[model samples]
Structure formats: structure tokens, C-alpha cells
Target: MALDQLDGELEDQEESSEELYEQHSFKIDGGQEPLRIDKFLVARIEYATRNKVQKAIDAGRVLVNGKTTQSNYKIKPADEIIVYSHYEKRGERIEPQPLPLQIEYEDADLLIINKPAGLVVHPGSGNPDGTLVNGVAWYLQQQNPEISEETLPRFGLVHRIDKNTSGLMVMAKTDQAVTSLAKQFFNHTVYRRYIALVWGDPAEDEGTIIAHIGRHKRFRKLYDAYPEGEYGKDAITHYTVLERFGYVALIECRLETGRTHQIRVHMQHIGHPLFNDDFYGGDRIVKGTVYTKYKQFIENCFAICPRHALHAKSLGFLHPTSGQQMRFDSELPADMDQLIEKWRRYVKAKGDLIVESK
Candidate 1:
């Protein structure tokens, strides 16, 4: 699957994130006859037409034995199959699961949440349960037993951040709210500011990154910033260096267009990727010293903030019904705070030798 598929839609989010992909896995019976993959899938999968199956195969959503398969490929006995789709599938529903959530604000129209890193926003094939959606469903249902998971609008989510990127998020509680909030995000009127600890000091105090972003051609899990604009969707991110530590820097990113991995990819395009961001090549010492002590310090910093050092520090949007602009801000999670502090002390102590390795 393309990273764009996993990135989740950035706009017009009235469509639930779960609806972006439908997944089904099957193991062929031992006595099954050899048949074209598409026909085989169509016959076994409910509500799936031959046309739809063939289209999925053509789009590389159908996999046989863990590899993308063409429609003409004959499925032999004991073949393993998996299919993904942008449409709905039968019997798919979010099973409410109780989870610890930090809700900053809540009301009839919408709610603001400070999502922690490591928590997925919604459920997918890899994560069938234990998602924000599951917890929210349980929370909402606790108040109103009549609410149905299948019928809830967008599962009440207006927008989403990446799983490992901690930050604030807004969710609508009603269909009317869904339409209003989704339009705000789609129109690019929503305000969102993120804090990122990236490798290297940016030459400029502030700059804008304008590029086209899409999934990497080779690595589907990572995105690529296309400076030439030959592929992908247009994206823009404005960033300001909040502090400098010689080897690395603390930066604030204001997103103009929220493409998937927008800040991470754009920063890398400009030679600065977020610290400890394994996906975009920030896990290693991109900058700083190769000396044993410096390496140890960086390794300790990694242990302090293990995930990508990005946080959605603030979010703003107009109230769905009242037109009152609602904005929320969050403190950096403990890990990032400690990581930054360690860098602050390190830079102060060894200012002259900080960039020795770079």
C-alpha cells in the first residue's frame, strides 16, 4: 500500500478514516481449482463485484502470498490472499474499547484532545482495536447508548495527526459539526502549529517550504518531497527556529497545507529532518560530533525522546454552531521536554566543540 493511503486524507474528512481502506485476508482451500485472482476474490468476498476486484488488482491493492498480484495471476491451492480498498466492506465496525484519553475540552458540538505519541488515531488492518476511535466510541456511548458506531459521522474525527506525532486534535460530535469542521480543514482555514526538534541548525531563522509531497517510489512507508512538482500534491510549511543548539535546533512549524508527513519530509528536503525520526533518516546523528562522549550524549537523548520529536502544540478552529473561534494549546510531552533540556545543557557546556562532527 502507498504511504499516501496510510497518511489519511488531509481534507474533506467527513469520510471516516477507517473507510479509506478495507482489508480482507483469505487462505485458499487445499482442493481449490486454479482460478484468476480477481474472479476468485469476487466469488468469495461479499458485496464485491468482478469489476471492483479487477480494479483493486490493477491498483496493487490485491496481494498474493504477500506480493502485489495482477488480475491474470491464477490463484493456486493454498495461496494466501489479501485485498485492500478505498470503499466499504461488509461487517466492518469499530468495537468500542476503553482507553485512557486526555480530553482537554468537551461539549455538545465538539471536543479537543491532547493525543499522546504511540496512540493511533483510528483503527486499520494493522490496528484492529485499541485506537482513539475505539476509546471515543466507548466514551460517547457511555453518555448515549443509542449511538451507533457504524452510523457515527467520521467516527467524530475532524482531522488526524500521525501515530507517533503527539499533539492536539479536534473531533465533531454531530453530523452538522462534522460538515462544518471538515470544511474548515478542507479550506485550509484551520490553524495548527507544531513543535519539532530537528537535526542541524537551519541557516535561516524562518523559511517556507513549498513542494509537492507524495509516497516515495521505492519506500511506500516514507514520503518524498518533490521540489520539481512532477508528482504528488502541493504542500507548504512555514518554520521558525525557536532555539539553536549548534548540532540540532528546536523549531516551530506552522502548516499551510497538511499533507502526510509534510513537515518531516519538507524539513528533510531542506537538509533538516526531525531528531529520532526513524522514517525520514533522523535516528542517526545527522549532525554533531562523532567523539565517544558526544555519541553517548546523543544516544541518551534518543532514549529520552525515542519517537520523532514532533508535537502538535496548538490548534484553532471556529466553533461549528456558534462561530466562536476555539483554540487549544498543549505542553510538550515529557520526552521532548527532557530531550530539549538535555540539548540546552550540552550546548551550553561544549559550545565550541558541539559541531565538531558535523
Candidate 2:
């Protein structure tokens, strides 16, 4: 089907007889005067962007005093306002192709899954199918027939994982759970830990990376720790080495402040970028005899693993309803295990001594 037709179908599925909008009337108080209807609506609704608000007004989706209004129409204090915003259809049709998922724990309120490397967490842009969100939606539908297209989680996504990374992720099942989890994430109260394989060993065994991260002005797709920009946000990540395998090191990172590509960018900032990350541009010994020896192995691994070597290994947070501490873990996926084992064997065969860590 065409993209526009598919979008229309999804939108129709999102509509419901149940009204989602709430009517409100604000009286002019003190010296306050009338404000633009679109501006007023923007202030009252969360997640409604300025452009979306404007579009809604232009499309006759907003009414002032029970009458349709223009985008620039002003609103008085006693004017009744009504908005017909059918909850945005945010769900995508991601076919569940029997993709391997390592489920750790599950309950009515939430689910924890050990996501494998190369799987897109949510669908967007180039990837619209075979996402974790699609799998979850399929699973939920299987478990409960009441989980209709309209009630599906368009906003229940409380947290996210990078496309190439593998590890544990917590998903909210209810809107209440979503709100509670979102608050916990915003407050930096949720405990998130990741295990990554980087290119070089760190000088220090453990240390904190405090840096301001923002978009690279030159490279929009990649992030950088810029000194100035409205974009940068404070990010803190603490990392410790679990074991060093000569050229590579397995490290555990704990996030104090979560930002886009926090662990990846911070690791790159410290001069130790992740292995096999083509975007960041790091050095790997894939040349001459070494390249020939591992070419087939690398090809096989890449065919199975399409993402970076990061994983959300552990997550801890407060349960929404019970208010009890909850934590979940996901073990390393099979492909990564195979890669590590192959590298280890190759190193040992080349007479490179392996260090035993107790």
C-alpha cells in the first residue's frame, strides 16, 4: 500500500467513539487579556508542538465558543474552547517475524526484555517494520483481546534503546505506568546500566565522564560535546572495566544523566570509541592476513548483527502501582557471545597471552 493510504488507515484505526478532548474555559483574571487560540491550546496540551497546534486550528479541529476559528483568532477569558484531537495514532504495523526476543520479566504493569543487537527498538524513517514496538504490540494483542488498535501504546513508551545496542528495556503497560515511569526517568531516579566492548583499555579502571553533549553542527546525524549551543545537555556516565582482552576491553557503564548516545558519545569523548562503529571512525585490525582470517566470520556476524556492541544490561526502577523496588537483567545475545569467543580463539592461536581475571 502507498504511504499516504497506510497512514490514513492507521489514523482511522486510531479514531474512537470515546472523546479524548476535555473542554475548558479560562476567565480573564486581573490584567490578563485574550490570547491567540492556537497559543492557548499549545499551553494546555502536553506533547502538542506549535506546528501541530497551528495545523489543528487551520483544519477546523479547534472551536472557540462552539464555533470554528482561524489560526490567529484570539480567545477571551470566558470563551469556551473545544478541541477534537482524536489521540494521535502513534502505533506502526511491525510484522512479528518470529524475531528472537529474550524476555526477562513480565507483569500487567510492565515488561522487561533483553533486546538483541541490530534490532530497531522503535520504527522510524528507514526502518518501519521488524521493530521491538511491533513485537510488543503483537505480544500484547495475543495476551489480551481487549488491546485494540486505539488503546495500544502510542505514548506508553517511557524509555528507549539505541538501534544497534542490545540489552534490557522496561515498557509501561498502562497510561498510569507510563506517566510514573516518565517522571522517574525525568528525575534521573531510574538506574540504567550498560555493558559495552570498546577499542582500547582505559587508563583508569573506573571514572566518571561529566560532559555537555549536543549535536555536531557540521554532522547533524552525530552528536558532539560542544562548548556552546542551545542544544547541549549535561550528561554523566560512570564506567569500570570488567576485563581487558589486549586490544579490546569489556566495560560496564552506569548512567547518571541520560542523553542521546550518552554512553557512545562519552566513550568516544574519552578517546575510546566502540569497536565496529563505522560512524565514529575507529581503528580495527581488519587488514592483510588478519582480515582474510576473520573475513568470513565478520561477514556472518554482520549478517546477524546490524548494530553496535552496546546493551542495556540492567534496569532498576520503582513499580508504578506497588511502589516497590524493581530491577531486571538481560544476558548477552548469542551472536555477540560467538564474536567474543571467535576473537578469543584467534588471539590465543596467535600466541597472544590471555589475562585471567578473578
Candidate 3:
């Protein structure tokens, strides 16, 4: 996706930190007739038109068999077509609200925030206002009353984390910062590490999860990990076991690519859904004994952290103007911290019981 024009008007659309341009891939059927590449794509892609497809082709964002192609090029049987589209956003401005925000780091070009759980990043659907973006707008307005929405890129938000996932996030204060930071995120150069409490103990202490993640076929709101790359975008997560209880574990996950719900979906794919993650089937007791006491203990832990046990623990990237490395780290929020401590105590007491019984 091109970053040539950062000052252009943008819409109030929802996008992840890692998704700068929407990508679509198609494999031509064996019996399909030859058709112009632009026309071929327009028919298949939703809300796409000949002009948009041709513009994408002219920008060399369309690839056939991994190579750039002309808009009029005839599609062939069994040919692979990939298209990258960077759509400009335009709509009503986000209402600046005086919401409380935890500023971790700030400079002339960017701002780092320790986002708390239960705070929505961007307004959408049920969330019309009172989001992180709205807070940032208010903050920016406080800093410069005359600042216009067009001057700030994504309203200073370069990336986002889930509302339930607390931790560090960076926002670009200037257009140049947005351009540079967006490139870093798209290139996968930015560093992101998450702390997660998963339901089961992984076989390996450390490993990498390579899968294509996309929206679930049946559950449009939820994402699924496709190991065969059958659908969705490429996603990778490197994980290391931090602590182990018999039934669950604390793990650190480093993202190589940021797809929507990448860590949550990938962990679930490997058979270890995040503890208490209602969307991915972790809301119930996935591990441990089925005894009443054990079940009650697990329920207590769930009550400690009502949401999914995931936190964006750290973030790193290059400064937009200085070309210097800038990294930030955050502590686990109270809920997650308390949950881990409870697990620790539970494991230790169980160990003591075993020792005494023997």
C-alpha cells in the first residue's frame, strides 16, 4: 500500500494496527474463461468497481502469479491473483471527549499510552463515542486548539489493541510520523509482545505458530486460524512459557504479523485458548479437575479477570524523525496480576497436599 499521501482525507473506518491495506487473493478456476484482470476482480470483490480495480492495477498493487500485471491482462486458468487496496477514509470527525487516559510516553512526533482494559480503541457499531481515539482527539485539541482532523493521521493512532487487551500502544502526532510508523507496522518491523494466560500447558516451552488468520466462516465477528492458508492473511506468533500450573500456563507471545485477534486465534488453533476468553471457548473450565472445589476455584479466577487474559506488554519502533530506537513496556493490569497470583497459590497448595498425602 502506498504511503505517498498522508494528508489526504480519511474515513472513520475500523482497521487494525497491522492492516494498512486490505488484501485479497484468488485462484482462477481451471475452466474459467479469460477475462481482463481488472474486470475479473471487480466482479468478485465486494463494493469494488472497475475504476477502483484499475487504479489498484495501475499502482502495481495487483499481482498475477506473484508478479505485477497490466489492468487489461487476460486471466488464465489456475493463475494466482493478489490485490492490495489502500482505501482513503472520509466521514464526520470523531467527537473529542475528555476521557481519562494514561500517557506512558510523549514527544513532538508521537505518543505512547498504557491503554486499560474495557476501553474501546476506535468507535464502531455499539461504540459511537468515548473511545481511545476520542480521548486522543481531546488531548490533541488541548495541546493545539487550532489542530484540524485532516492534519492528524488516523487521529494520531498508528495502531490499536483490543478493548479487553490492556497495554502499550503508540499514536502518531504528525503526518510524517504516521507515514513512517505505518510503514514500520506494515513491514512487521515494530516489536509487540503480549502476556496471555492460556487454558492448557503447551507441549513445548517455546515455539512459533504459523497460520493464516481470517474471520470465521460461520461467526463473522470472530476470527479463526487457518494452518493451510486456505483463507485469510498470513500471521505468525512466537510464544514462550513463562510459568506453568498443572491445568493452565502463563505465556509470552511475540507477534511477527498483526492480524485481527492474531494471538487469541493462533493460541486457540494450537489447542490452548486464552483463559476466560469467551469468544474462543475459554470462558468455561478447559482444564483441571471437574471436582466442585476445582470448578469453584476456576470460577473464582475467572471472576478475578472477567475478560480474556491477554495484555500487550511491550512495544518498540523507530522514531519517525530521529531514526532512533524507541521501546516501551507496561506492567500487567490489576485484574491479570491478581489472576496469576491466584493460580500460583492454587498450584502451590495443590503441591503441598500431594507431598503430605504421599
Candidate 4:
């Protein structure tokens, strides 16, 4: 029933974009007590806060019984409700700049790009220029000489990969493209796989991590994973080992639910953080011995990657217009390949080094 509701709301909205993709519907049970709609919605919604619900209400994105409702409207039993949330394009104009872009695929509606490490996906805070969007905007402006930079649409990305995670990304070039891609993401049908070099080999060649991922209560920037699903949104990460180097392993990760930092947090929960992931304490020598040589070897490996050893290797989805499925694959980035090579040489030179218990 929720899936059906998702489809209806998506089709009805014309202001859809990558940032504004969340839509869900719910019905109050027969035994439910009357409560303010904003509070009720926040409790039922995943990753939602009170402020967000109130903001949505103010924006008239929340409907009760097919009419826009205020934050204080009391919900009753069997009452139908729909909540829509997404970041509206801001009024502030984004200045376009010409920058180098690696275009993997381009058509009338979208562009697929092979993003590199250390490049931020969108502009915010300290990074306001040299972003992928600015480059794309410039390219679009170049193609349409009649269209001025000021008239270019604000943004086009349907999803995002982390700044340090090099990989392929698709961005919409038209309003219809954005809506179709958003629906696929909301329904969890968009296929994406990642390659990661982590601190240790898994006992099984392949496995899955089903856990709830939410922001840490104490650490503002970190996430704490709950296996019992008591808190946070549901997240599942399936991984398979591709290679092992005594202290580290190359693995493939496929995501079933795309929560923020899902792979990094899930791997850390399982004692195998991504190699060189500075945020989750993987930057240290997590699985290697204390020998000086071993420490130096790991340090060199860190230098090679310099960031979390993660790459988005593949993407698949149904075409927005043609309704045909498309999948794209990419070779490992040079930095990750170099890091893997270093590990291979180290493991070969020194036989399997057992990792002792903490």
C-alpha cells in the first residue's frame, strides 16, 4: 500500500528533483488516539526530525484526507496522510565555472560521469567552486550558447557518492528525468555496487550486514549501527571478498538501502572498517602486527590511497524515457589499484602474518 502511495504522489508532483525525493503515506490504525499531525508524522518517518516535519507542514507538503494540513491538525483513526519532503532549489544563483569533467555517457536527458577522489559532489560550506555541478553547468552553457549562465537550472544530480569515494554518478538534465530517477531510488530499484579495500578478510567469502544506521548521539559527525532495528532507518550491505592480503581484503559491496555512510558504519560495526577511512578509525593499522616494518608498510599504503579505499564501481537503472534497463561498470581508480598492489607485494614478501586478539 505504501509503494502504491509512493507512485501516486511522485506522478502528481511537478517540482521534483534529486534533493526532494522522499515520499511516504500512512493510515492511522483503528485504535490510534488523536495527536498533532507533525508529531505523528515525525515518529513514523525514518530519519525525520520535528523541525523537518514542521517545515514540511509550512511548505504545504503534508496532506491529511486529501487536503493540506497545519502542524497542529489532530490525526484520527483511519485517516489517510501523505508526507513529501525534499530540498527545494534555493533562490541563490550558483555561478558556473569551467572545469575538467570526465564524461562517460551523455544523452539528451542526462549525463553519467566517472567522478574522482577529493572532488566534492555539491557546493556547501568551504567548497563553493570547482564542484562537479559547476563543471556540468558550464558544459551545458557551452552547448546552448543562447542560454545564459544565470538561466541554467540549479542542479541535476539524482543521487550522490561521497567526496572521497571515486565512482560513476548520473545527473538529470530535464524535469522528467529527475522525477523518474527519484521514483526508482524511492522504490529501491536503482542498482549500485562499490569496491572497497578493508582492514581484514571476512571468514565467509560473501555475506550480508542487516543493521539500522543512525547518527551517533554523542558524536555529531559519526554514525552508530544497531543490529536489532530499534533506532535509525533499515540498512543492508552485502559484501564478498575478492582478494585477501593477511591484514586487509578487497571486497565488493552491494547496497540494498542507501543510508548515509551505510557501508563505512556497517563495516566498522563488524570490525573491518574501510582501509584508510579516517572518520571511523580505520586510518590506523587496524589489523596488522605491531612490528615496525609492518607499521611502516601500512603507513605507505595509507599514503597511496590517502582517503578511504572505496570506489563506486557500477550502476544500473531503468531508462527514464525508453523504460529499458541500463547498467554501467568502471575500472578501479588508479589510487586504489596502486594501494592494492602495495598490499600484494607486502603480503608476498612476508608470509601470512597472523593478527592477534586485542
- Give the TM-score (vs. native) of candidate 2: 0.68
Best by lDDT: 3
Worst 10 residues of 3 by lDDT: 3-12
Per-candidate clashes come to 0, 4, 4, 1
- 3 versus 4: better TM-score goes to: 3
**Top candidate when judged by TM-score against the true structure:** 3
Better of 2 and 4 by TM-score: 4
User: RMSD in angstroms, all models?
Assistant: 12.3, 9.6, 7.5, 8.7
What overall lDDT goes with each candidate model? Answer: 0.78, 0.65, 0.80, 0.76
What lDDT is reached at residue 106 by model 4? 87
| Segments in model 2 whose C-alpha atoms lie over 4 Å from true places | 1-101, 148-152, 227-231, 283-306, 346-358
**Candidate 3: residue pairs that collide:** 10-89, 10-90, 11-89, 11-90
In candidate 1, which residue pairs clash?
none
Model 3 misplacement above 4 A: 1-90, 352-358
Model 4 per-residue lDDT tens digits across residues 254-310? 988777778899999999999999989899988857799878888888888899999
Question: Which TM-score value belongs to model 3?
Answer: 0.78
**Model 3, span 1-358: residue lDDT tens:** 2221212222222223344544577999999998998888878876667775675566466779988789889998999987754333334457899999999999998899999999988766677799998999999989988765655644766677888989999988876676567667867899999999999878888999999987787776787888999888889999998888868888999999988889899999999999999999999989876899999998899899999999999999999999999889999999999999898888888773211100
TM-score of each: 0.75, 0.68, 0.78, 0.76
Better of 1 and 3 by lDDT: 3
